[model samples]
Target: MAVFEGTFAGDVSNLKIAIVIGRFNDLVTDKLISGCQDCLKRHGINIEPNNGQVDYVWVPGSYEIAMVARQLALTGGYNAIICLGAVIRGQTPHFDYVSSEAAKGVAAASFQTGVPVIFGVLTVDTMQQALERAGIKSNLGWNYALNALEMASLMQQIQNTSSSPSAANLPPGNETIALPKVTT
Candidate 1:
């Protein structure tokens, strides 16, 4: 019998990530973005797009994040995509519609593209609540960023491991080849 499992190393220095930010609530979204960047940097991952390590995309609102994320994922330009936004419940039912769609869409993008699409969007009852999560009290963006990195790394590790057969099953010089690297 054989069992396979992955460990959470969380080392993301060698991976690429994307942050899809919504501009509707720029005040809160900006803070979330900052927290995410700081977290990634502390984890030894650079957020400099010029270095081909991280990329950032701005959209009108939460409702628009998934399409852009899907596009980025399809292009194979990122190992993981983090969607950041703040959806504060309003007087109307607009909040419910938008928030649910955003979550559903982002999830769909992940499923359709086979890429890790991290949902960092915040759906809160008030502006204060959104601020609290963004940075005031608990910085969830930091956690989301870390999660994306961990998931991407783990997935890659699993793919690498499964490509090779056990030592006893090898025949001649034929060896397993690793998956192709994603191109920008």
Candidate 2:
């Protein structure tokens, strides 16, 4: 049997994350939030005393996550934003529109604002799928949380590399240097 262990050694000490959850599927969203919080805490991020490390907000539904996330990213307070929602397929085409719009909107917000906006939304064909993804037994929330943290860390790395004068002035010969392998 293969075994996996959780480890946190990346430079996420000063990163700030904003979680915008959709109340449409409160249960699943809550699980996502819990997982996100656990991951953040494990990474040495402080969320209390107005430390401005982590914050969260609730919106009406999945369709509203993009707008709220965009607004939060525009505030220049958070390094990354995690949008959580669950859209279960219904009998109508409403699910298609909402899911596509939410995904595109979040992507647009990330590109336009230059902030890392993670799409943690679950677009499932059944409630069972959502439940399975949210349940601790399945470890889906843990997976999503890991994704969010990795994305946040990547964004920070990019920002840091872009802002450094030496990096900006890299010689053409060193432009394609390979990145070190990631152990975990």
Candidate 3:
């Protein structure tokens, strides 16, 4: 049996990445971006905005992250995309709709584009909890970046392997599945 896996120890310096951030909760999202940048930099990825291997895109809110992410993914320029946002629960049901849509949209973008889109949005019960996760205790943005790295590498491996004659011996499965394109 053959196996393929992605690790953080690979050379990601050449991989282009994009981070789409939601400015709705800058307090938490900003820290998340910091943590994410730290991880990518540690892994040898240049995090300079617009002039390096990574680009940062700011959206009005989490609700808009998906649209922008999908657009970027469609461009076929980025090896992976990381999304950062914070949606704290409020007294009203507004939290539910926004969080759910953001999650779904991020997933849809990845599925449609066959690109790695990391959903780093935080859906916390309170500001304290969001802060704690953002940096107070640990930052999930670091995790999100790590995920993007791993997925990007894995996808690359799969693409390369799939084209080889060895992949033809694998079990039979549908290889022509199509995903719907994202519309306005």
Name the top lDDT candidate. Answer: 3
> What lDDT does candidate 3 reach at residue 62?
95
Q: lDDT tens digits, residues 66-131, model 2? A: 999999888877767888999999999999999999999999988878777888889999888888
Tell me the TM-score of each prediction against the true structure: 0.86, 0.80, 0.92
- Can you tell me which runs of candidate 2 are displaced by over 4 Å? 1-11, 47-51, 167-184
Candidate 2: minimum summed lDDT over ten consecutive residues — where?
Answer: 175-184
- CA lDDT scores, all candidates in order: 0.85, 0.76, 0.89
User: Candidate 3 residues 1-184, lDDT tens each?
Assistant: 5588887886776688999999999999999999999999999888888666998999999999999999999988888999999999999999999999999999999998998999999999999999999999999999999999998888777777667776666666835333222222
Backbone collision count in every prediction? 0, 0, 0
For 1-184, candidate 1 gives per-residue lDDT tens digits of 3445433355556688999999999999999998999988887887787887988899999999999999998887787899999999999999999999999999999888778899999999999999999999988889889888777876676566656567337677845444334554
Q: Look at candidate 2 and tell me the lDDT of residue 50.
A: 69
Error at 168, model 2, angstroms: 4.3
In angstroms, what RMSD does candidate 2 have relative to the true structure?
A: 6.9
* Candidate with best TM-score: 3
